[model samples]
Target: MPEWMRSFGRAEDGAVTVDWVVLTAAVVSLGMLAGVAIWGKTGGAAKGIADYIGTQGVDTTPM
Candidate 1:
């Protein structure tokens, strides 16, 4: 029933900080999820490029 206690309960000075922290965490989690989703495809594409390069014949001659 104290005024100070009521004010403390109603204080919202840190609300923005909390919101920023939550939003940053959400963004980082989403980025990680996207990276994980693309991880396998990226590796496969890189390997395919490597295989294609390996299969190509290289001619070494002087001009």
Candidate 2:
């Protein structure tokens, strides 16, 4: 084989960039999933809080 072909086969330094890209993509996907889950819960939580406040017998009418 030629010297250049042997050199290409022996090189290992470029793999780190690929590994970092994959890791970053995985982290971003997980973050988006977490945001979706949290968003789904937010409305329910707000409703619960409002219900609790309403049950306290305070007048809900605006001043």
Candidate 3:
């Protein structure tokens, strides 16, 4: 190989940018999953509370 070509064909030492991008993507995905789970539980809890209140004859209609 020509000396000029050899210099241009050097192997990369490390790939910090790619590693960071992958890690950030993983964290974001996990966070979104957790948020969805928590949101579902919260909605269920709210529904249960509303049902209990209704059973107790509490008037929930807005004035």
Candidate 4:
């Protein structure tokens, strides 16, 4: 009801800061979700590669 309170409510000085914080949070959340989705496949692929490498024999022939 007061003039000062009304002016404060209408102020836009901190709007950009609030927008940036929200945007940053959304980006970080999306990145974490993407990483979690890929992590399972990554681990499986890494294990398969390691198993394949472990089966190969090292040749020690001297020139």
CA lDDT of every candidate: 0.96, 0.94, 0.88, 0.97
**Using TM-score as the measure, what is the rank order of every candidate, best first?**
4, 1, 3, 2
Model 4: worst 10 consecutive residues (lDDT sum) = 32-41
Q: Write down the TM-score of every candidate.
A: 0.76, 0.56, 0.60, 0.77
Rank the models by lDDT, top first.
4, 1, 2, 3
**C-alpha displacement of 60 in model 4, angstroms?**
1.8
Tens digit per residue, CA lDDT, model 1, 1-63? 999999999999999999999999999999999999899789999999999999999889877
**TM-score of model 2 (CA atoms):** 0.56
Comparing 1 and 3 on lDDT, the stronger one: 1
Better of 1 and 2 by lDDT: 1
Clashing pairs counted in every model: 0, 0, 0, 0
Per-residue lDDT of model 4, residues 1-63, tens digit only: 999999999999989999999999999999999999999789999999999999999999997
Over the stretch 3-37, how does candidate 3's per-residue lDDT look in tens digits? Answer: 97886678454568878899999999999999999
Q: In model 1, which runs have C-alpha deviations exceeding 4 angstroms? A: 1-7
Runs in model 3 deviating more than 4 A are: 1-10, 54-63
lDDT tens digits by residue: candidate 2, 1-63: 999999999999889998999999999999999999999999899999999998887578998
* Higher-scoring candidate on TM-score, 3 or 4: 4
